[model samples]
Target: MMRFFTGLITVTLLLGGVGTVWLFLTPSGTNLRYLMADTLITTQHRSWAKYIIGQHAMETRVQAYQQQFNEMGEERDTHEIHPDSVPAQAPAAGTNHEAETALTEKKPLVEIEEISGHGYSGYVMTVNDPTKIRIGVPEKKGRGERVLSMAERTGAIAGVNGGGFADPNWQGNGFQPIGIVMSGGELFYDDLGKSKSTQVVGLDDNGKMVAGRYSLDELKALGVKEAVTFQPRIIVNGKGLIKDAADGWGIAPRTAMGQREDGAILFVVIDGRQPGHSIGANLYDVQQIMLEHGAVIAANLDGGSSTVLVKDGQVLNKPSTKSSEGRYLPSAFLVFEHPELAEIQNVWAGLKPGDIDPGKW
Candidate 1:
């Protein structure tokens, strides 16, 4: 009995030592500490994990990391001309002739290509005209809708998850979006008071991809057709915004959107968390992918478990969540055959923010 006990203890010690070594020596860009922290907080003993790692410390670290990357500066000439810089021009009273002509011309509406690099492999969806893109919101105010469901309901040929949602305790109802959600030129959700100057990703009436900081009124003035708000614009003007992998928002599953100079929208989704299959990708990897594909303007969308790409009623990428299908989200950018024909009703029309509880499913 004594001998057996000694052998068991020795084996346990050896395994623990090996695991610790692997975690530390894996790679320079790997976020082993974050992985451990996330795992602990997500498990049933979250209180214990918080006590061990100090929630405040973890949050401070995360903020510091994000701040470092955000301050790295944008690539020059990649951003749209400031609204104030443009001379005032008469607003067209009806349909834009130029936009209509561009839409009617023969061009590939959507194309998907496989993209790969040193540490990542994913797909880049090229949208010829940004006008065909539309934001799909959930029908119910307090409940979320799946991206696939939104795509099917809207008759979209392709769809990708959009924006961030209020995920309380990581078990949110997924009904509430964290920032603004504008579809069909109408504001459905706004949290500008809580967070000033959100980074918006959308399109103007002329099919121009609009990305940058904007207020609700500014969005209105810009004639934004479809928009959703999120953070940390990764590329501006054909240059990568993130400086390095360590500051690349802690490597994980990623979903980002960008636009080329030719008015083509780029959608990228990198699968993650499945160790042997796809560990994940950092913001730098995503930035590099965007640059290689000729993206002049690019920004990160709600990634992690919300990352998804669907085409023709089929999921294109492997979602990192246990659900496999992907999480129910508040919004998704759907591609339509006739975007002008899409009739999207405001789900949050009569409801106030207080009416919804993110903790409730």
Candidate 2:
């Protein structure tokens, strides 16, 4: 019934020449109501029928896009776009694929495949080798989130807000957060609570490296105190304090400990060799691989369907390829313009620590 009425309205509106006005005037989410409210009057030209028919066409368009949004699940709930969504405000010059990757010799990762979809834009700071990547998560956070929390920044398997695992905020009307990063060695961890030096250095749309709260000491304490390993191994600091901790995103929180052979401690996320996730890195597999990579301390980030990497402008590893469920994350470490580091610092000056809110899966 809905489909039949919608089609009729669309044809009538297109013929009436009011489609443009109707589309522009009609706000998102109001289309469905407009369609179901009124009846058609074929002979009534320039009247309510035109308005009604226009609304129907717009409603149909919205539903079509809804399906597309579902395909890009992460964006389903993020209906209202930020100013940054439009093409008017382009990213910094070098942040784009060509400019960012022009220095192929300097940044190999930026020149490879690109995956600039996930509410982010990146630059390859120093892709010395594929194994060692230094990603930077820029400052563009979600609309409702106050600030990107530690859980989000670390790419946890669950959202910190109300989705995924469920929270009272969204009223259980959300999906699970499934996000992760891949590395070969255990990375150091710390807390940025008290210290001010070891701050967050990321970008703002204008190509700048902004500062963040917490010093190296603080980060070291909060990020990594212990380490563990999983497939595609690396080291991650383990010590994210969740007062009401339920799941450590994916892996056990304690596993993110130990050092590596090269002494480059990075985090690693491993997963079970299941059918859809046949290539994933898991704990058991992580231990074996990290041991080979000389990983002494290793911990898993969000893995399984969450495993992801962006080289050039493409998603390096399959990010939830098998699962329509995108990786639910609270935060991430994307790479952007280090040249604008000073600019980023300026933005940081006006900010406080822990300003970004965590999202629900």
Candidate 3:
């Protein structure tokens, strides 16, 4: 009997070792490693995971691997557009005759298309007029609202997830935005130090998509009508800011906003964390897609479970969350026929940060 037990234990140990080796050898396992590393770095001030793996070393290794794969130049099921295919000159900053001409030319006001790449599939929505876009804020101060609810309430034709929010233990109410939230040219939330700059994604008064680091005064001076704070601008001046996939904030569900040379807004949503469908997409993949679609400027939005797309009062993309709709959010970019007429109240008025506790929800 002792011999039998010893044999079983040995078999179990061998199987465990084999399983570990097999997992590391698989593409999914590679993706999992990067994803875990990214989450650890972003969510924590100082991560033990980074200490265990050596943050710099892990990043270097990932970048090298990605670079090697890119050098291969092998084409798989990728829908990427070659850099040369895009026009040499993008539209000038702010609205101009070129932008007007592009708008007058033939193109649907809103176009939704399926986008697929080497390892993932997703959707992109293109909006011709940037002025039609506006931010939808919840009515109450300390709570959150779903994108669908905000869309229906505001009579929006389409909506997509907006800024990042506070989520304690990944269980917060999503009521508090990390930084500022500006709607209709009004500053609704500001948590940064005075004169400090934060990366914002929004539209200026000229109806052009504006994304970059800016202070509140700078944003106001630029005539930013709608804005949300989020990080790591992926593209600037028709150039991909991210070097490679390794630097591309690890693969997961993603939401990004961009503008074409013609001033068309691009909303991208990629589903992740669901195997057998779409594993996920990195910032590198997103940059390529935006370039292929003619985006000269782009920035990442709040992704993960908050990544979602809704059109015509229906959820368009499959959100990577247990909730079929999506996690409640603080804001959403809602599209309307006459945005100037849409009424969005200032919900956070008269409330201070200390009054809110996201974890309670």
Candidate 4:
């Protein structure tokens, strides 16, 4: 009996070793291994990914991804949206007067729907009038504010997280943004100089979604009303840029914004990291969702633990953070009944990056 038990344990160990070798060292498992590493890179445990792949290999992979994203941003968006045709639900030439009046009456400007993919579930919000969307920032001076707070303070009907920021050691106070931030046709914050360019995602004065790489001067020239810095325009000119799931930047909570030809804005907020519920989505998945909803242009926003959707001052999506309130974000795209009247003050108006302390409360 002792000899039999010893043999069984040895066989089990051998099989485990073989399985590990097949998973980590074989070409067939390259995607899976890289997916694991990429997912880790989004989290605070980025260094843990080096255990799966060697340190040098991990750095190479990350750099390659950065290059690919930069190349994607180089492609210019040549599409334009007509905001005048957005709410064209008017009655035809020959219709009853009462019915026509009813048709002319305003519909709900914002519509929220539940959306689910392979291993993720979240919400897709459709704002009929794109011009009403504005970027909301914290009113306080020292720290960032939550999406719910931003929406409530600005009297916005709905809101979602926006842009990347300087989050050092993943414990940042979310006070500092990474690149340029323009709100209400004013340059609110800019880390890049006048000549240096960065990838931007926002809407212009005509309600046209402006994305891809642009300098501060170019953004101002284009009349960008609400702008923030983020990555890789996934869908441009009515085509998906991400080829497949492998290049989809390894599934995590994703918040992306898009626009249809008719000038309706689409916001996709996906939940992730919850095992039994939602595991998250990659860029390809987000692109597919936007395309299916008739998006001609789309770009990713600040996601992961920061991804949250708020409507009427209520949290709508499941945030992956320890607190259900979601992370305090530097900026959020908010929808208002009259966005032009929404008073969004520039919290970082006179302050430079060195003036703000991300660790301070």
Between prediction 2 and prediction 3, the one with superior TM-score is: 3
Q: How close to the true structure is residue 115 of candidate 3, measured as C-alpha lDDT? A: 85
- Residue 222 CA displacement from its true place in model 4, Å: 0.7
Question: Model 2 misses residue 65 by how many Å?
Answer: 42
TM-score of 4: 0.93
Measured by lDDT, the strongest candidate is 4
Backbone clash count for every predicted candidate, in the order shown: 2, 101, 0, 0
Per-residue lDDT tens digits for candidate 4, residues 46-162, read: 999899887998899899999998888888889977766556486988899998988888757999999998999999999988889999998888788999999988899999999
TM-score of each: 0.79, 0.31, 0.78, 0.93
How do the residues 1-361 of candidate 3 rate in per-residue lDDT, one tens digit apiece? 9999999999999999987776567777666666667645443232544653467856675567445433322221112223223343455568789786785565556789998776678899988777799999887767889898899998999989999888887778888888889999988888886657777888887677777777788788878899998755777777777787766766778899998765678999898777888878888899889988878788889888898899888888788778889988999999998998899998888887788888875
Candidate 2 TM-score versus the reference: 0.31
Instruction: Tell me the deviation in Å of residue 346 in model 3.
Output: 0.7
Model 4 stretches astray by more than 4 angstroms: 1-8, 84-105
Q: Give the alpha carbon lDDT tens digit for every residue of 89-122 in model 2.
A: 3346547687544543232222321212112221
- For candidate 4, the 10 contiguous residues with the lowest summed lDDT are 81-90
lDDT of each: 0.77, 0.29, 0.78, 0.90
Model 4 clash number: 0
Ranking by TM-score: 4, 1, 3, 2
List candidate 1 segments past 4 Å from native: 1-57, 69-107, 194-196
lDDT of 1 by residue, 259-316 (tens): 8776778999988767776767878888888888878888888888899999989998
